[model samples]
Target: MSQSIHTETSLPIEREVQAAIQGQRALAAYLATRFETQRIQIFDERNEAHQIELPTSALRLLVDILAELADGNAVRVVPVHAELTTQEAADLLNVSRPHLVKLLEAGELPFHRTGKHRRVRFADLMHYKGERDRSSEQALAELARQAQELGMGYE
Candidate 1:
């Protein structure tokens, strides 16, 4: 499923929501201890109960999501194979659309064209982002090293 990046998806910090999320997080943490799968019961407003089995991995993911929500952080789950428009990719990378297009044109990032529009795979975008972040860190380290060598008082 495709989602437009323009929509607001941030978590709300309302007290009631926070309380409910905290309770759910505690329950998820309890369920995460099960080895193979977890059997949980859900009760409706009418007191009707339904039982379901969830894999331990899925339970663990739920625990993580709930924890983030409890901490008032926005969370998104993007499939690795999903294709994103340039604007969406740019938003994810915290860059402008024109800059992302330039990267695509320069072959710094891979993209596929459908008609006249370019699409980037989520996995490829993440790979490029990781490399860019690592390169930036190395550059910062080198600059610090040079300043120290010159006795620029960076230490």
Candidate 2:
């Protein structure tokens, strides 16, 4: 069975969200420019201290995630081996449940049956998404080329 991925955050006002997004962007930029590994120290209210080290790549990913969250975006972190439900996969692809089912039925995307439900591997879904994006980009480029050739005022 596939597990649900929940990413819910509440920030009612737009101004607060904008401020958070700006702060995240600035922190991300600073982290990107910094060369040294980051060590984080946490102190509890009771004065207990804890320290942890973060690799640069992991820090970069954290920064990106933070920026997305700050921008009021719901982010879900799934392991590469995680299996997602049909609804979750559809949501990730920004398509309807029926459409995603159609793709699965057509073998356009791979999925496994969990009883009556379909479960898609996170890695497989990501691969499909990347391929779809690249295909769209290529098709758009081709259309632009054709438009340019026809003097349709397209750059």
Candidate 3:
């Protein structure tokens, strides 16, 4: 559900916004028919959705989102970052800037110093994620095996 606007013609922007939110083919058709205005700038729903007037090229994006929603597809944006600043990297790793600097200092992981600041590669973050996932999987497997041996649940 999203709030709509009628800043342009006072015809009924809310109705159009409602159509977009519903994400049905009929709704999409209604929107296309109603708002002859072009260019809709859509942003990630993480914080807030701000509206901006876009050119006709943005129609493709609108169509994609509507189609995805209509097909019951989860609309999510994966931040496929290839590189990040020291602060961003620290945030990703859930570590403080100082601690990350310590890792860089200790030569534990490879990092590039950009002038006075440092940057971490996304590959390193991916590697760390894989290692953590493997550890979690191993722990879960062990727990399941232990439960089975102890006859914890009914067969």
Task: Point to the candidate with the largest lDDT.
Answer: 1
Better of 1 and 2 by TM-score: 2
Stretches of candidate 1 off by over 4 Å are 1-17, 20-28, 31-36, 71-73, 150-154
lDDT of 3 by residue, 93-152 (tens): 788989888887897767887798888888886677578679989999999999989999
Q: Give the TM-score of candidate 3.
A: 0.41
In candidate 3, the residue pairs with backbone N, CA or C atoms under 3 Å apart (3 or more residues apart, or in different chains) clash, namely: 39-54
Residue-level lDDT for 116 in candidate 3: 84
Q: What Cα-based lDDT does every candidate model obtain?
A: 0.86, 0.83, 0.65
Quote the lDDT for 37 in model 3.
61
- Candidate 2 has its poorest 10 consecutive residues by lDDT at 4-13
lDDT of 1 by residue, 54-110 (tens): 887877777777677777777777788999999999999999999999999999999
The RMSD of every model to the true structure, in order and in angstroms, is 4.1, 3.9, 12.1
TM-score of each: 0.74, 0.79, 0.41
Scored by lDDT, model 3 comes in at 0.65
Model 3: runs farther than 4 Å from truth? 1-81, 102-108, 151-155
Compute the lDDT of residue 7 as modeled in candidate 3. Answer: 24
